[model samples]
Target: MSRPLIYKGRGSLGNAAGRFEKHTRRAEDDGWGSLDAELPPLQTEIIVDSSQSVISYNDSPDIPFDRSINPYRGCEHGCIYCFARPSHAYLGYSAGLDFESKILIKPEAARLLREEISKRAYRCAPLALGTNTDPYQPLERRQRIMRGILEILAQTRHPVSIITKSALIERDLDILAPMAEQGLAAVYLSVTTLDRTLARKLEPRAAAPQRRLETLDRLRAAGVPTGVMVAPLIPVLTDPELEAIVSAAHAAGAQSAAYILLRLPLEVADLFEEWLRQHYPLKAEHVMRRVRDNRGGKAYDAAFHQRQSGSGVYADLLAQRFRLVCRGLGLTGDLPALRTDLFRKPHAGGQMSFDFFD
Candidate 1:
């Protein structure tokens, strides 16, 4: 791994220059460790910006929800395979470690969500969370942005669907439980793999698989509609565990299940390649070969319909495996639609309509 050079009181450009100097010195010294042996502790920086609007609209035919909200930019989960990793390039940052360490929080998200929904043109639909980045990432613990958004949704009696890999959702059972009772909420717990060691390295900041299972149980017990998402099923890496993961999630009280095949787009391809070489060096070549087979002899194929699930015999087999296991486990192929009929706009000075009903 190439160590990022740090320059005290200097920005990224200065740091790069320092790295060049260090490289020259190391080459002259015949590859010896620096005499000052201590490495700097990794620091996470968060900048909170107040977004004018929270709800973002999407017209993609492949996605289920038309509207979504992301409370934070650049996830802390550190999943190398995340297709959203490429988004960090817009910020002039590397999609590798920088994508996980530099986080942007939307502090005014809740207020903006309320304002958007109160508009006369606003239509009722299930608002999705964690679509681009996990809404319940570790930073949410302190920022409470997701919680604030949920609170607004609850206040308006709006429908919501969340996809997350964190146990932090348990903390909002007070809000989710009530919303679920009214058919206003559903949750999807994303479990990529059951292997603890692999999960630790692949998704360093995410909650453990076991903890996620427990979270599902808690949500089910609380009467919150819940399901499991075995997302981005890697070709050779976690593919073999498809059935096992579905069966285990079923046993853990997941009412439905879904999966997405691995997608390597833009910077994500290079980032994932680096990760495979670093962690699964022995299987690196095999994995990339299978991935290419799925992608029609390339690292990725970005055609609209073919983007989510690749095209090939390997992709077909993976889909077949998922369908068979899901049926055997008696899990619903898709989540029940959250009720949008219950939605109401909350006014600034007046109480919400639901409050009068209460």
Candidate 2:
């Protein structure tokens, strides 16, 4: 068995015990005798997926879109606060370092998308991308699955919305730019903090804040409708820089903006706490204190609207600050609605056609 240690460019507290296992193991570092010293550095492990379908739909009122797609199951960004971390436990992996090192890719995602969109009963709506995991993560450079999906969307004139923290999205401007002109595409760059040091630990593999800003600028310059998302706003942590992030993104050519409070559901709570102890030990208690303040004295409140915007005075104050800043910056609660009338269904022979009367 391979030993486990923290890699230089990864974000994790090393492998914690897998939650589903019958027995659990603990690591002790009393100095007199420590087992952690002999462990080898953890490495990324790629897992190929066999997805039967590509599009995932939900009827949740909390979500703005009815359909979304996650090209990969596990994200390489390694965000310590990622709510998606617990999802790995379903695959029998630990919610700690295992979530960051193990990556899963759906090789036939594009082909599956093409088939689904070909159905005669298909409905055209803005497909949300990167809702679960980043479609433009580092593995994308080799997989090219996202690029293939974009090509199909562009060819079919399907509307789509993308949210990511990667600069790699700029590579698909060739397809996105044309779709944007027809009101069929929009992009949102999620910026958590302006502090490069914090970002390095927060999401070790994600693009830097400056690089994301550059990506937004390039996308807008290419005529792609772009926006900014100050997401998972951590109280007393990244919260202090919320306004600054929006301002910087605005200067980078973002016309729309939004924010979401941090979410630590399921096993993510332990994963994140472990991360805090490893990197921000001194401030961990204070940080989590404020996190619980807005979450009704809990680490998280999963109640619909309250989930995105916490409850209580702290939550209210955060909301008010966001409203004031958005008003001052001329941003509103609207993003351009992608066009559905332009959708063209491909015939059985692979020829696309749209009926004007219908």
Candidate 3:
């Protein structure tokens, strides 16, 4: 077998072909000695997504929100275990390295969102951000697409729920704090693991676990309802930090908590397995065994209710432990329901109500 390819700060072990690709390619060492030479660093490529619509509705019974807006198609955070990675294949890109390096940004997201929600038939409901990919990913710093979307939402008095692992959200306190004061906004920071070293490998470009906690505290201090998500809880790897993460978030002023067990769907399964073998070779089989125990003897099961948190003995235990710890930490309740009553229908020309100014 050939040696694994490890990019300095990237999470994928290798750039595997997407599921739809008919051609398969691999690197083979010829006697030329070029295979051992250092590879050029990967650069992020940005593509503009000219999609006319911004809101995507889903009927998945597992999730709470019905509609969501993803300003970007591929995430730059390079999380090896991202469930959204497989989605890159639909765009004719690899679900491995290409998913992080090639990003599709929607520069007109705000205008499209304004047009959609301003319609006479449109109904107001809390819109979700970061459901598919992190809205505050590193690219957002320069793109500011998320900020523009939030500005429109705030002006229309629309309710929104945001999830992210980036400390960059702190910079939007001026916008979020006021919306939250009116019960129109809530934010959840996904804390995967408390160990800084492990986190760097698992989610290479995301904010450190400690930095996320500090950002949560800052958001709470600014009167923005803040919560914590112990997301993608890997069985034998990061599950041990569950209780500790909840406790730490509670200490940091988290008012609500949630979690999702590790999900390895389609191309994500192979990518994650490669990551596991590269990072924790000895424990890879043990970890996958525990995952299969939860996933009904397979690498993954996509049944509605069983997909997020698996269905089995191990799954039940994780759920029970999360509930018990949350109860103990006074984080059992959900964030206040966002208000739709304050929504103001915009004019046909996409002009927002000026009631927000006064």
Candidate 4:
């Protein structure tokens, strides 16, 4: 059966197509003529992921935050280049389409966060939301865990930073706007490309480029500190749109800008390679050639300082261009610090506390 390169409203699962040595979901010939040749309809499955805690701490020097919270494990937005795809393997799921369709949810994220934050030794620092899989993925509209976490952060006056590409975030402005008023929150909306067609094929389920721009404007108008992240900059595919994206975002009220180079780590490398072969067959070889150029002749370089920004001719040039364009548009601005001193644990109402116990 001839598999489809693109699905209408969804991203193609990486597991169903292409050749890889190892995979949990195996495709077999059903001997059903056209049915065998056609891509089957895929459905999204949300599984409950019970957790012992919600907050995850990281000490990576390159990452700005020491802690983050991922309300879900696998992302349904299905960006083919997602570095988080490999995370699904730990759950015995394929990192391809299975990673996009099979999701894991932390049902008690908000409650656990409240418990963690209310502990005596817990010190406040800027915690990032959506640092791994997007906490505001399409499923967030229904799950609302992200909103719950935001509520807990709001009630405790804990500072946070959010990064996402979903327009659903606009739905939480009531919580976000009020928090923004006190410098407790900021947002960085990501726009990968201005071309809608390319965006559909690339990110599959993410909002359109124009919609993200509108969201940026709305966030800024609501007094939320907004910025733009032109992330996972593919060498030949979306790299050309860098300057234009930065300029548009700046005009849309983005106060600052940042970017990360394409990272084809582990299973993601195989998935993206197959994706390139399917969509950009003409330039697949050329594209990966440049990717390797930036990755130091390897599929990826995990070196911390050198990882976020790669090392190569094109990488150096891209950095130079980003700096020049950001400076020209004044996308660099001093951001207000999120207030840790404002943190006050939520009072467990109606709970008995002995007066002068000790």
Candidate 4 C-alpha lDDT tens digits along 1-358: 3454344556654474323435444444467664345465678999999888999998888888899999999898999889888888788777787788899999899888888887878999989988889988989988999999998888778899999999899999998998889889999998889999899888988999999999999999999999999988999999999999999999999999999999988888877888889888998999999999999999899999888889988999999999999999976664677888877765545222332111
The local distance difference test score of each candidate is 0.82, 0.86, 0.93, 0.85
Taking all chains together, each candidate's TM-score versus the true structure is 0.90, 0.93, 0.98, 0.92
Clash-forming residue pairs, model 3? none
Give me candidate 1's TM-score against the actual structure. 0.90
* Model 2 residue 255 CA deviation in Å: 0.7
C-alpha displacement of 153 in model 2, angstroms?
0.4
lDDT of 3 by residue, 1-358 (tens): 3556677778887777888999877777887776788877788999999899999999888889999999999998999999999999999889989999999999999999989988889999999999999999999999999999999998988999999999999989999999999999999999999999999999999999999999999999999999999998999899999999999999999999999999999999999998898889999999999999999999999999999999899999999999999989888799999999998867779765568644
246 Cα displacement, candidate 3 (Å): 0.4
Candidate 3 lDDT (Cα, 0 to 1): 0.93
Which pairs clash in model 1? none
lDDT of 1 by residue, 203-267 (tens): 87789999999999999999998899999899999999899888888999999998888999876
lDDT tens digits, residues 217-245, model 2?
99989998889989989988889998899
Best by lDDT: 3
